[model samples]
Target: MASNETPRQWLKRTAGRGARWTRLSVIAGTLSTLVLLVQAWCIATIAQRMVIDGADFSSLTLPLMLLPPAFIVRGLLIRGRTICSARGGIEIRQSVRRELLERIAVLGPFWARRQHSATLSNRVWDQVDALQGFYADYRPQMLLCGIIPLIILVAVAPLSWAAALILIATGPLIPMNMAMVGIGAKKRQEDQFQEMGRMSRHFLDTLQGLSTLKLFGISKHQAQEVHTASESFRRRTMRVLRLAFLSSTVLEFFASVSIALLALYLGFVYLGQFHFGMYDHGINLFIGLFILILAPEFYQPLRDLGVHYHAKAEAEAAAEDLMPILNRRVFERDTDQPAWQPEASIALTLEGLSARYAGRASPALDNVTFELHANEMLAVIGPSGAGKSTLLNVLMGFMHPEAGGVSIKEGTRPPRALTDIRPDDWQRQIAWVGQSTVIVSGTLADNLRLANDAASDDALLDALEQAALKHWFDALPDGLDTRLGEGGRAVSGGQARRIALARAFLREARLVLLDEPTASLDQASERLVMDALARLSSGRTVVLLTHRMELLALADRVLMMDQGRVRALDTLDALRAPQGPLARPAATDIPERRDV
Candidate 1:
């Protein structure tokens, strides 16, 4: 079932499962508090026996002798609580990170484009790091702090109601002061997170585009911009630190004052200068010492909470940043039904298609129309920015048309809009080879198996032969098993393109879409690619987008697009003849194949 809960709610629900550990930790904490109270009681009892009864050191030592067991119990509980808190911290961090990744996967390319890579990285690492405080310290300490104070008050009330009243009244002041000072600190921490995300994104952008900057001789200027962003982030961090210190200082001041006031009240009782109704016994050295030792313990959690409050604020700020991308709606229509089957042959039709990019004034493709028949090879030739790539994207279902839609004709179905078909289904029937070949980090066989996981070694060899990459594979020390570096950077550009084509060949899809299949190849390699393409297209539907005349000549029909519309669609000879749109070829034109 789909969950309607927001991210924060989801986090709460997931964290609540750790209630078992929380309960265990609280039990240990309470046991530790009891041990402390026993130690205090033992001290008071021993002192009363020593002073009031005038007893010798060896005569009355039972209460003092019980201290060892209490100390041992306290030590074990502290260690166990620490372990539980650490486990909870790890669980929350991992759970939140996994949830974020799953949401991103569901959102796909639509959500990815809206977010900066570095910003997302920061949220996953830096923002999630802040949540350690929430799980590790704040949560556990809050429980312990509340429980310990109540236990203290209950134990002391019967013995000295006036002392218990004073302790309870001043205890709340620590947290009250924290809340008052922490509000502004939390706000500042949130702003600091935003600035850090912006800085990270700017740095990533600069690094990714460094080659372009160097080519244009503007690298230094871009470097200066990075420096400026870094400086801005540093300043913001400093502002956050200043607020943090101020909040800590304020919390400390109030906690110290409260502790001092409690001590002074106990001192008056110790000197027999004051007395509470029905509790006339003066406070002794033992009681005074107990109160002094417990003073720091009572205030320590509040101080820690002040610090963790900033961490929670930073985490929430990051969550707010990532929430929109996770919540974004991508193709709103349902696609739960099984896919339709394509017939033996496929035919594509686009009628009155128009598309304008988001936040753009002019349409990239306007009123575009075309028809590609079954088992026919069509070549779409155009200049840069002529909407040739846009056409391919729309056909592949990567982008939706604003006005009319693409349709596929199979048999008695008449014609069904591409949007009506599932993208995964349509993609399975098609083999796409583009200019910038993507080579994942793996062995040659691993990359080849991406198209058809069930492909045998023999089938992979056949694909390599078809792509003219068999010789290259043979030269490798491990043949198809040789590892490729990241993005195939270890191989030449031409080799990477051949490997990509080999992948497409392995798929053996009925519809083959080649976008500049021979762009990176030499003359000999180009001929080999063209021959392989001709052989592959013999019994399949092929759509080739290129400017090369030799490849265009193989097309059953050539489409010449200008400005977002198909200006001509006919035989290559007819289009190249006098009075055709591309009648005159420039001298510098190399007739290279294009890729979308």
Candidate 2:
């Protein structure tokens, strides 16, 4: 993982893998450097003839003409380098984001529940964007810093070996200074990114719960907490920025000192005081002019590297958060494996099933055993926190069990472990309706078609009718095309529940799971939902969790659960028998039944 990798090593590894994109950028930068060399030679030659040799404008014509084109070409190369770098950075960002999204989808709800929406958003957006400079600017400039200075040294060697020696000797000092100042930069930037994430999460949570805070008259207190968090984040961000600024200042200082030393040495040679390293006709106008002009260009790439170094630090920090997610182990599946297609009838068996969550004291499902026959409807009855929802999550492949396993048995075929089933296939054969409806901001038809994107308008209408929502849509001006939910028309609690039911009805799934689907509905709404549910459950295996006695009549059998264990599984009449343990009023009294 990049978390354990050194910042330099991680940067090199990721940048190396993207050589196809970055190669063009490096080539462009090198060509630009070569063009600058030609420009410097042209300027030096022209100056020498005009000043020392007493040449006229006619003698300077060719060099003057060559000068403009060199500058133009150099400018064009710089633009090309910028373009190539941006494209490479964008390509890398897209690839990484795609991989992260695919991993999140495979990890399912269990992993998603563990992460805050704000934290994940920060990772996918801000953290990913931070890598742009590393791929585009830092990687290419790193190469140029090494090669360009060597090119300048070689160009100076023929004129005066003393100057070449000075250039070579002083070049290492800038990087040495930059390295010393940049100590712990990666860790600091990582901490900065973390603080930003925390700030984002805190703000989002506070904003979402604004109404609740107002109700409790503690909105001011929460606001103060948010302000405090923002201040902390601001201070941390400044620290990282300060470190970057200090690194840049140190690099510039060394580069300036190196150039000054070269200038002083050239001045002594020109004065005829130091003449040891010069060749014949040494330290004349042309040689002195050329070497002096090229001095800053020699240190230019290093200065640029110092500037791009912050990008490396930022990307390293992002990678520390990014790599662990990419390296996470999710549900294993063979690439060549086909989707699992169930028959018209589907039966499920659970053998000594047990599942637990991290850092939890007790198992969510404890040695639970049950068989669901094909086309049978079973109602699960249990108090709050009795593992009803956990069972559904396990059945849907969202959560993995710690011990034992679930398998599907087909007619005359061997039972296959649920683990053997591909996620896409398993999900294709099942539909779910939770207690609270998910009303995304979209058209009524848009929301309905989410269950089956390929479903026709007629199919959607049929599902809506089955869920007892046909009248509501029919009365709307746009009918099934009516816009609803957030940012659209608001829907009541019962209408939203029916929409969720309609989504399930629209699916071609052979199995259906409903978790407290009618929990908060009034009698009228419950009757409507139950009517739609009864029709929807026909020819499908259904597992429902409801407190409504009327809904239990639809179940072929009832499963009683307490403390993660199944206490009984029997026909409703059998369970309701006077002598039956599940017949107790405390166990059987649903809200509606108790009021009755």
Candidate 3:
């Protein structure tokens, strides 16, 4: 995936890594070629015996009996070729997708946010599928096209050097013309894939935003935009198809003309106008028929390779998109890194911490610093654009700091830098409740078990009770087994948030991070969620971000932030004293929580 690598070179390198599969395909194709040579010889010999020898039907019985089984064996070999090619395709495609998924896992949500999910899904699924024919059909045929023609030439040379030279001379022309058409065909295919990706992204976005469009009464206008995009994609696809068809036409033109030349020479010699290209017998039906039969077979593999050339072009297009993602460098915890386990509670410290996003002019968190004590609730109250969420993200091991650092300590052990801690180990020790929850396509119990897979039914019920969802749970037709998320019954936003809270309650972690846990909720739902938060935070160190005055009562201290810098970190009483920015009077006027 180096920048200097051409698309063809990149594909060769990737497909080379899965050489075992490619080898299987090549071997199958070679066996098929050998069988085809035998089949052609058998058919030609039978025709020569009957036409030139004028043999009786009784004399032809032996060859007639053998020809059927020869064809049967050839058919079986062709079947095997197909099976081997398909298997190779499946194995290679699986390898690419597995590697892609692993790389994406290391990059995490930061990468997902920057890309359209539909685009990624298409590349992983449909684009990978496109590579199947390249490995299965095109690659094997590439070798067959080279080897099979030489084989035909060698077999024919013993009969007539004239026909042998014709095949040899014309063989190069097919691949030469193929190379000429392939360059433009490949470029067109790549452009078509890009257009497809854009269409998918646009369509998915429009679908997700349809409700908003309806609200603004511009749904019809948006529909026209979608239509235009779809039409553009259709036109691009047709262009690719035309190029593919043009390449086949050029290959067939060369192959047909070569066969015709061989036929013309054989025809003249057969009719006695020409007396050359024979081994003393001048020209007989046997040799002439054999050489003529071999002519088409000589060019058959090349024609097939040309036909499946689009598979190669399609796979190259997919690889152009896939290679960058596969080669992307992302921070991943070493598997050999020591796993850290804390005793009861943990304390955290941020010293002059700073983080900047790509293409941003300034750091999202600049010289920000704070401390959280064990078994204490610390609330961060910050205006919009004050880096509150960035701080939480760093604590959750989702973002790496660009400058300064964070450290965590438990019991008597010295504090360790956050970078030194493996994310999986550290994340296992804490539970988080974000503003919006991800309700996956599964049952309620399945989602809850993601937090603590070992939790029993009783444990799950207790967690639901703690999240103030017991009443809703009782009304459920299927209770915890009810399917939620997409393609299932939908849950209210408040219910979804509470389901997330239930997951947190099941974790029983000593550290909890809350990001406006009750934002945008109805007053009653907010009260219920706050009650759940109160129970979930008991005896746990907590970091909460909120503009809700009611939740500030739960915080022992408050960190007031503005413009990516901490203005003050002091007790709630101190922050509420006289002229403080977060005083009761000013806190009441602050808007509902918003992400920084």
Candidate 4:
């Protein structure tokens, strides 16, 4: 979480971690300040010597000798400040990025589902870019602005109190004016960022749904939506630009006005019309001339502070959006439990399970009791909206049940809820093949390695052969090394599914969960997939969720689901009897299978 401090306070907090660098920067800034003051004093002394005493050039050589060292010190200080600032900026950027990545990992699937991909992408890149100002430009400029003016006042006061007083009075006005102008600018900048995020999200959604729209002949309508989103984004950005320009104009006006007022006062003293500090003598002409030259340098840092304030405002807006993700509630349940290591065969049970979505009237799964012993296959059959997929999510520990629990039993200990089991252990023991497979952009070997990083070339080939994809791989120019396009777009749908199944086979998990794995395949592809599934489930626990009744012959038992509850569970033959609740409907497309 970001500190809710004022800008100055927040700047202080950010710099506090880099105290050593900050101290070095401050020292350099101080040296730079002293050099500037020395130069001013030397010029003033030289002018006074010439005008008041009518001195020659030879007599003024000693006073002019002080210029080189002051310039050299000033240059060195500037270089030091630059180095310190760069180091600080890099450290801060790395720290923030690390924290953001950790938060994302902690939030897990819940956060990923809720967040727009483009918005998250922008936060990871653009928002972090925006934060560079707090470390690089803002902190250093703030130090200089806060410290240099005081140094100038001390240097100039003894020489000409009138000039010092005028500078001191007007110096505070620059930042104050900026603050007033920026209040509205910050709000507008935030709005612009939000609008940009909205546009990004809409574009991503449109791209994802473009295929669907094309299938339905409505892609042209989606294009119109894209155009509208783009224009809205453009208008919001113009508003942000308008506010930025107005802020700059206001800061410039105040800076110019302050400098002009100081100049007016200096001119009066130059004409011997103003006096201060009990001297009946009018202001010294040489000192008045030097003060005029030095006044702008004193105010220069303040003007820079004003400009960087806009950058800070933009950064804060980004940070505000990021804060909720960093502080989200999703990861609060992870405990300090030991890692799970099962000693015997894996068995699973769901007892009186019921779950509802966050804002739903009724449960998606109610009293859904079932069990699968080791090396057994269970087929779950249901209509389109009968919660088959939801059951898989709960059994896989991706979702928690509202009224019951999923448990794993072993030889010794009492049955433990799936929630209590370590996630790494559960994931290591289970492999999933869903209707939509993930085909990352990589070579065949590279994709296989995702399931088992230590799998040898021979092992990969064996898995591919089992999934009926070995001939496809062999025909490719590079064979195992052939590169697949993004999401395996280069491959046919059946080939992609085979690759996914090959990945699952390579994992060799104790349990396999298949969700409509043959959904869109042709007859030959479906037979190949079912054969592959039979081979993979040879010695593992298998749960198959499908609508095809012909596949039930492969299962040891079949569970029928209706609404959110399990209607019946029995052997396939028993469930197919005339009196069974799962008796085939008149419109069912499935053909009964004969014994092999």
Q: How many residue pairs clash in each candidate?
A: 0, 0, 0, 0
Better of 1 and 4 by lDDT: 4
TM-scores of the candidates are 0.82, 0.94, 0.94, 0.85
lDDT of 2 at 104: 89
In candidate 1, stretches whose alpha carbon ends up further than 4 angstroms from where it belongs are 1-80, 110-116, 128-130, 139-148, 205-225, 277-295, 339-345, 409-417, 487-489, 535-540, 577-579, 584-596
TM for candidate 2 is 0.94
For model 3, the stretches where C-alpha displacement exceeds 4 angstroms are 1-4, 16-18, 54-62, 280-282, 584-588, 591-593
Q: Candidate 2, residues 1-596: lDDT per residue as tens digits?
A: 53466645765776655677688888888899899888998999998998899988898988899899999999999999999988888888888889789888888866887899999999999998999999999888888888888888888998899889898899888777667656677878888898999999999999999999999999999999999999999999898888888888888989999999988988887787897778886788899889988999999888988887878889989987887788776667666677678766788999999988779999989999999998899998777777887888899998889998999986667888888887788898888887778898889889988899999989988888888877788689877767787677888888999989889988878999988788778889888988888888988999998777788899999998877899899998998899886578885764332100
Q: Write the per-residue lDDT of candidate 3 for residues 1-596, one digit (tens) a residue.
A: 47667767877876765577667666766776677677677777788778877878887777777778777876777788778777878888898899999888777776677789989998899898989989889987887777878778878888888888888888888878778877887788888888888999989999999999999999999999999999999999898888888888988999999999989998888687877766765567777777777788789898999889888888888888888888776766577889788886889989999988889998889998878899899998877888888888788777788889988888888898878878888889889998889989999899999899999999999999999999999988898898988887798878888989999988888789999998878988998899888988888899999988789888989888877898888987787778766566646465565764
Q: Give the alpha-carbon lDDT of every model.
A: 0.76, 0.85, 0.84, 0.77
Question: Which sequence of candidate numbers ranks them by TM-score, best first?
Answer: 3, 2, 4, 1
Off by over 4 Å in 4: 1-31, 38-98, 211-221, 277-286, 331-334, 411-414, 487-489, 586-596
lDDT of 4 by residue, 109-204 (tens): 543656678999888887777777767767778888878888777767876766777787888888887778678767876887888888889899
Collision pairs in model 3: none
Query: Top lDDT: which candidate number?
Result: 2
**lDDT, candidate 1, residue 86?**
72
